[model samples]
Target: MSAPYVLVLYYSRHGATAEMARQIARGVEQAGLEARLRTVPAVSAECETVAPAIPEHGAIYATLDDLKHCSGLALGSPTRFGNMAAPLKYFLDGTSGLWLTGELVGKPAGVFTSTSSLHGGQETTLLSMLLPLLHHGMLLLGLPYSQNALLETRGGGTPYGPSHHAGADGKRALDEHEISLCRALGQRLAETAKRLENNRG
Candidate 1:
């Protein structure tokens, strides 16, 4: 059997969400699991703009098999009008095969997002990411008030998941609170998945 791992899948436009994914992956590894970071190609209106088989930088493209076999999941995306970016949505929309076969059932999952403004629908975007996971029968995980950062964050921490305020130009780095919450969410998801795996054993 393959070794268990957590998949940190995200679509980052200007790098903030990607940085969050890295922090979350750090937490996953801190919990003693492999963190597999993957990303999707951007979708274009033209429908003919195809991305290369491999990205020039950052994490490699994600395959359905990665999602299917992951012991846990940390999903992230940038906010688009209070929703997840279209590329991430498009990726999830193509996962009906996994849904149909129940490949992701019982896996622990969490969501994260980066928004251009403090009130730029961070929570809503996180919630939007959860819908597909729910349909896959995956167990949802979130940051608890016990994390402290969630309670004190002035930028982008939520009970739904971790978030970031990327500023109007999308260049703002994640603040300390946001990073802590991202790591917390990842650790929580990894620990939960480990416990669940043990139960299954």
Candidate 2:
């Protein structure tokens, strides 16, 4: 059987959220689990628009099977009106089968988001991502006080999840605290998943 892996899934418009996914993946790997990074295609207004099955550039598109089989999950997105982006929400809306089957039950999941403004709903976007996971019966994980970075972040770190403030110009990068919090979230999620797996085993 294949080894356990955490799915680091995300959608990014200005690339900030994508970078957060990479950092979280690194932390997942550090916790002794593989990180499967994946992305969803942009949504087009016209019904005729379609994205290629395989991405021409970065991580491949995620299938429902990927979400069902993952040992843990780190879901990220660029904030859109205080909620997750359309692409991520659209991909998740297709996972009814997995939810019915309870394949993700007891698994650990975390969320992250990036916003163009400091108060642009970073925490709310993370919560928007978590609501679906909760319905799927997955255990939600968040940064703890043990992770000092969560307390020190000036830009965007929340108990709900890691967030990034990409400034109006989108020039801001994930600072030390944001990066550390993302990694910490990944590691914490992997650890929780590992423990749950062991208990079931």
Q: Against the true structure, candidate 2 has what lDDT?
A: 0.90
What lDDT score goes with residue 37 in model 2? Answer: 97
- Residues 38-98, candidate 2: write the lDDT tens digits: 9998887685226777788878889888887889999999999999998898889889999
Strongest candidate by TM-score = 1
Error of 1 at 174 (Å): 0.9
Weakest 10 consecutive residues of candidate 1 by summed lDDT? 44-53
Model 2 stretches with alpha carbons more than 4 Å out: none
What's the number of clashes in each of the models? 0, 0
Error of 1 at 170 (Å): 1.1
Among these predictions, the greatest lDDT belongs to 1
lDDT score for residue 6 of model 2: 95
TM-score against native, each model:
0.98, 0.96
